[model samples]
Target: MRFLYLLRRPPYSGSLAAEAIDSILVAGVFDQRVSVLFKDDGVLQLLKDQQGQLLGHRSVNKMLAALPEYEIEELFVCARSLAERALSLDQLSLPVQVLDEVGQQTLIAAQNVVMND
Candidate 1:
């Protein structure tokens, strides 16, 4: 099955981002196709050189780095979100496809299941 995880929360706002990552990993482990979309402030999760350790939390970047090992490589970010935050793709920890409004809608519509966090 194809699973799309929509992340709309910042990395350290609370535990939602981490929980979503955990869920994605689990889905990947079960051999399900998984994709992740970083939207809104959730795009912050991809910023390079974040220091979650300063907040006594495990590094979200490090956790996200493990996605490739699980074969979950379809990562995307909202173009408008990044532009609004003045972030360029070069500033992110991983290479992600930047989706505009129409692209986002098409991608979401192609998914078998969409889970938002």
Candidate 2:
């Protein structure tokens, strides 16, 4: 089955992002096709050089960076979101496909299930 996770929150802002990570890992473990799209403030989750020490929590980036090893290689980020935040693709900790608004809609429509965070 295909699972699409739509992340719309900033990283480490309580448990939302962490929960999404758990969902991704669990889904991937079960041999399901999984993909994640970072939108709005969620794009901040991909920023490189996140320091967990400063936040007194483990780096969410650590888990996010492990996606490929977990067989979750399809990472997407919104182009407009990044642009609005004055961020560029090269700033991300890991490589990700840039999706425009229409691309995002198409991806979500094709998913068997979409869980939002």
Candidate 3:
């Protein structure tokens, strides 16, 4: 089944981001068609220069980079969400397709859109 996982919160606040990443990994193991969408503060989860380890927290960037190896390549980031956070596409490690509103609507039209807030 095709699954779209929408991550809308920052990674540091709780385990939502971690759980999503874990889900993606497990899905990959099963050869599932999984796509991840980074929206709102979730864009921070993909920032290149994260200092989570300095705070004794595990960085999700490494997981972001490893997504492709797991065949989870349909990565996307909401353009408005990035702009709202004052972040640009250049800041993310993953090759993300910028999803504008129309694109978002189309993406969630038939597939199962799972939102993690």
Candidate 4:
């Protein structure tokens, strides 16, 4: 099955982001095709040089880096979101396909299931 995971919240804001990552990893184990899209403050989850993190939490950057290993290579981010935050694609922790607003809509339309966090 094709699953699109839309991560729209900032990482480590409680358990949502971590749960989403866990879901993606589990989906891969079941041989499901999974793609992740970062939107809104979720794009902040990709910023480089993430430091001074809160105590008792796993590294968001580390989990992001491990996505490809789980065979979840179709990572995407909203171009407008980055621009609004005054960030460029190069500033992201990992490389991803950048989609404008319309492109994001098309992607959502194409997904069989969409999970927003």
Number of the top candidate by TM-score? 1
Predicted structure 3: lDDT: 0.82
TM-score of each prediction: 0.98, 0.96, 0.91, 0.92
lDDT of 3 by residue, 2-27 (tens): 88888887878866777778877887
- Once superposed on the true structure, which residue ranges of model 3 sit more than 4 Å away at CA? 113-117
After superposing candidate 2 on the true structure, give the runs of residues whose Cα lies further than 4 Å from its correct spot.
none
lDDT of all predictions, in order shown?
Answer: 0.93, 0.91, 0.82, 0.86
lDDT of 2 by residue, 58-81 (tens): 788887998999989999999999
Clashes of each: 0, 0, 0, 0
Give per-residue CA lDDT, model 1, range 1-117, as digits (tens).
889999999999878888889998999999999999999999999988989889988788888999999999999999999999999999999989999999999999999999998
Top model by lDDT, which number?
A: 1
Ranking by lDDT: 1, 2, 4, 3
Model 4: residue 49 alpha-carbon error in angstroms: 2.1
- Per-residue alpha-carbon lDDT of model 4 for 20-99, expressed as tens digits? 88888888888888999999999988888776255467777777888899898999999888888999978888989999
Worst 10 residues of 4 by lDDT: 50-59
Superposed Cα deviation of residue 108, candidate 2 (Å): 0.5
